[model samples]
Target: MTDVFAGVRLLGPPETDGEYIALSEHETVHLHEYTRIYAVPGLYEHVVQERLRCTSPQVAAAGFLRAAATLGLEPDSMTVLDVGAGTGLVGELVRHGGVGRVVGVDALAAARAASLRDRPGVYAGYVVGDFLHADELREALRPYALGGLVSAGAFGGTHATPQALRNALAVLSSGAPVAFTIDERWMDASDPDGFGAAVEQLVADGRLDVLERTRFQHRVTTTGEPVFYQLVVGRTG
Candidate 1:
């Protein structure tokens, strides 16, 4: 019985479902193995929160609520589109934020299945596909007139490519808000083509405006080291 992905604690003897590992050799696993990871039941949670101590979902959701409050907007009036909604954790957070309708999009079918299996009714609709394409998904959610976007811990190296951001930006209604968090290490103020610079351009060009950004601990790596991320809330201007 081994829980290879369940954080640093050497829990009880590994059951058939859990993969146990020694403390020294744990940093090699990739993060997107949703099927293998989710199949272990509570491994994702244990690894993400118990082990890594990830808090992006909760932080981003709370920031969205506060920004909405600052604008005198009702959270219940928001129709939210959650991009890369792995396991529906972020979707549940948005629902808890009082969003009127939630549409979840993910590239992996296993993610959708896990969401339905573990957190049914948390999302109004779940679509499985690449979110970088706008045309196919546009009509699927047209009825909702989506006013907000939630993409917690989704944007990254390849997933957060400029083209992807351009496309995700195309799916929103003007003036709609978008909230997300990205690893701070992936960003740089001096690097002109960096993710942080791109997002800052989106804000400066009047396409968006940064409402709030807080540097916080997102979680831990397989090696028992803390990983930090920035929770960012912005609006389509």
Candidate 2:
């Protein structure tokens, strides 16, 4: 693929809070400003996937497939809810992995538009709503009978919060699978995101039965350093 980001330059590693410079436009944008990134077709793929080498989508999909297999479930028999489904990257992977249906949920209209524009038909439906305030969305999703949930690269900093995760979990049927990946730091006990404590409580309270938790390099930073993320696969208890 041609380098769509040839005029874009990434500076600093993730640990140092990386920033990007668009040489052609002479503008600086944060690495996490996904709305702006998705506005330009192939810019996100070029910067995040090609340049930084993000692999969360593939890793999360594989984890979800493994968890489904462990539960004696076939992917084609499942409908999955994809939280933070940015540009349908994860949803496309899950759909190609044989999921019967994939519904995407993102707070940004730009994300939904980008998904439809780039990977048309990947998601059976895409809803724009805050997961924390999704009572109507929950009711609307009932018809899909979502059997699984997957989130990738959407659980830290200004992204989805632990409460959003809990809200997503509330919609899944008992025993339905859930898979997600987050930066390892965010999983640390002291992290302000509260994802670590929330996950622990879910497991302790028998709300989710964790099947696998693996730490892997989620991506390479702009400086070519590794950024690790933890992939957690589980089933609702």
Candidate 3:
């Protein structure tokens, strides 16, 4: 817990009995490995923003705002849906940007608990279930009439798949705006991972606009290496 906005410094992951832990750090900490980090209230911030200098939440929110401005739509009029919402950090930013209502969907119950613990009143409703698995998720979302979907730093991971993205989008109104960011490696054509194909299809078929995309310093790795990611803002037209 240090001055996060000021700078990023390297700090190795928690150790027990001088044993080495196998944890990979990209801009912030790894999402999948949340158990060790989330045990401490602010340790996630310390490792992600302070030590690793991850700016994904901020960048993702900014990208959504930029797209809103371009479309001449006020953020306050939009009903926001945060897919893969981790602890409601990105939702907080979106709400601050004037989004009328915000709902968060996360696979882990820990995410919902952490969001309520860390940032209450940020999300109108927080659901604990995988979008791909839970049937109640769709029913719960029906009342929101979501106008925009903002998912930052939470795509193509083990929790989120192309099928899940398709399901999430299926719940939205037609041409709903969607903005998200992911590591650029996911965009590589040579990669056997299906992410490249999914993203390409989503963009090509007017399922995603892909308006603004830029490579920026997402955060530093645990080994003190800079991690770059592509932040994309777009409409789902």
Candidate 4:
């Protein structure tokens, strides 16, 4: 698999609309073909984490820990919810940061299966359902009394919607720390449906209080092109 992955070359520009990777001596696949990627163990880690040099998992975990500290919350006293918890990388990081328990949520069942297979016991529970529309999801998660919400590389594009984010926040305890990363471009207030504008609405409505927001390289494309994202750390009102 290493050799197979090593032979891959990412197609240009890392455009959000579409991206491709030509596998060395193998085949090309759409970058977002998560179902295929997650099916094979270590493939996602090799491609996205090691090959692409993605940094969102580390950034999100660190940001969440710092935010939790700022809010005077003890990790052992709370259970954190990880949105778009792909393969449990962020969940493992948060756990290593002393978080007593972490729960993972993703729309794809493959993601849940991969997480359990690749990184066992990292998440106290992993929910496979739509964050916005799954009636069973919210009720299933409500029992945990989620204290913090954290995500990595899960927003923007066709991923989690702002409405989904709102629903997650509603389940959190007031003042629970929120940490996530999204493409910097999506944070723009100019795009009404974008996270940037959505965040403004959240702030204005007193639903969120941002503490730290910074831009950092999320990862590089197969062509060594840098992709940046905004690490947003805040607390719910």
Which candidate number maximizes lDDT?
4
Best by TM-score: 4
Could you tell me the C-alpha RMSD of candidate 2 in Å? 2.1
lDDT of 4 by residue, 130-182 (tens): 76784678888877878999999787878988888888788888899999999
Q: What tens-digit string does per-residue lDDT give for candidate 3 at 1-237?
A: 454333433445455321122333434444346755555566567666665678989999888888878877888988888988877889999899889889999877777888888888999898877767646789878778788888887776555776777677777776666778887777675665556677778878878877887888888766666777887777776
In model 2, where do residues sit more than 4 Å from their true spots? 13-18, 23-25, 190-193
Pairs with steric clashes in candidate 3: 27-219
Clashes of each: 10, 0, 1, 1
Error of 1 at 137 (Å): 2.7
Clashes of 4: 1
Candidate 1 vs 4: which has more lDDT: 4
lDDT of 1 by residue, 1-237 (tens): 235643445333234433333334543333555676666555666667665577888887777777767777788887788888878888898787787788898878888888888889998888877756667777777776777788877777656565566577777877777788888876676777667887888877887778887789887665556778888787777
What are the lDDT scores of the predictions, listed in order?
0.73, 0.85, 0.75, 0.88
Distance from true location, Cα of 81 in model 4, Å: 0.2
Candidate 3 minimal-lDDT segment of 10 residues: 17-26
